[model samples]
Target: MAAGAIPATKLAYFDNMWAVQATATLLSHLETEDGRRALILDSTIFHPQGGGQPADTGFISGAASGFKFVVEDARLKDGLVYHYGSFENPQDDCVSIAKEGEEVSLYINPQRRDLNSRLHSAGHLLDICIRKMGLSHLEPGKGYHFSDGPFVEYKGIIPPDLLQIKSKELEKEANALILAGGKVSAPVLSYNEAAECCGGVLPSYIPTDSAPRIVKLGEHPGCPCGGTHVADIADIRNLTADAPHTNGMP
Candidate 1:
């Protein structure tokens, strides 16, 4: 460690709730070999690539300037948040850079964020529905919440005869929750409290005494998570589920 250096990026998106437009201080910068220059922020409203969701892309500019930099990616590393993108530099067009410690405004692409959020939330809701199906034995696992083709993987096998029935039931329950307009109610809780919300079984990666971020749909039980989400259940539209392959999911 340095004699005196900040250890990592302070995250703001956790408390941002739903901030599409915000501001932060430029903490540092990096230029990748691919030619993309990434700006690190002291505190960020950007959601980094973690929790099975993709990073958020947006723009970072001087507090009052027209357009200083275009942020293309946000990532979390060792507690630091990196915003990767380019800017229109006044000095030259070849490269764009920002001074560290300068105040900068940030904005996330609304359309992209909306889709990502909805799908991510849908994945969570699907997990809950799976439990409701009396097949909790399936055991939830990895989730691909990307907008292109999102799905939740489970550890147990579904009897081949129940595939179609299960798929249809999943769609119906997921969509029912959407139409029901369940209010979102995610809150951070102490380790014990969080564990209880997750049915008293925290994921293996979570320490027994570590506080965790949780997400819940309306009155449903909350699950620990770290991804942006739609404000309400209704925000997720046209959610569908595909039948598990005979060979099972990857």
Candidate 2:
């Protein structure tokens, strides 16, 4: 009802990542430096930029008055998700007027969402592919799953002599799993159950007594993730490789 008032933004994307459109109530709105603006929604289907995934770009329209808000990015500060955009009323002259407690429709750009999800899912699948190439001890370190040029880093570097061969092998294996079309699952579980779903492994930051969200891609290993992912591996038909590169061996 007011700017800076934290509202629990129900991220429907977590409930069903496949949803691209949703109706939301405008809980609040704020104007930043130089008139930049943002709207806070009670519940949104948009995934805010975080966890290496780019923010969702979309538009919101007033359900009744038909005013348009061109949303360029979604962000999170504290526990609230902000839909950042330009607000306009083409037919009216209300300066900086988006009413509080108004009904709005959110439309997430499907192409961007699909591409980002594919690339991100591929990054995880790449880890499995690498391990399949007989590098079992290599732990996942960092990842760059942006659509531009996605790559996942491991704790140790692979031999230069094997880079070309291994990358190609990894690509082949990853694509095979993609083609196999296994179900991608996101489930919440207690730490022990989460660990069991993920091959009895829990990341150091995950509290043992807390429930963790897990993503399982087919029969391959599952991991804790908050990023949006495709519902099926088949959605990612082509997960290519550009050779495995890494930081200096540790």
Could you give candidate 1's per-residue lDDT for residues 28-83 as a string of tens digits? 66675677677777788888888889888878887543447777788776677767
lDDT of each: 0.78, 0.81
Off by over 4 Å in 1: 1-4, 33-35, 64-67, 93-97, 248-250
For candidate 2, lDDT tens digit of each residue in 1-250?
A: 5555666788788788888888989877777665668888889988898877888898988856657888898887777888888766455543235676788899999999999899888888887777777887787877776877777777765778887888788888888888888999888888989999888889899987898888889988798988889999999888778766555422
- Please give the lDDT score at residue 44 for candidate 1: 83
Best by lDDT: 2
The candidate 1 region of ten consecutive residues with least summed lDDT is 89-98
Give lDDT for model 1: 0.78
- Per-candidate TM-scores read 0.90, 0.91
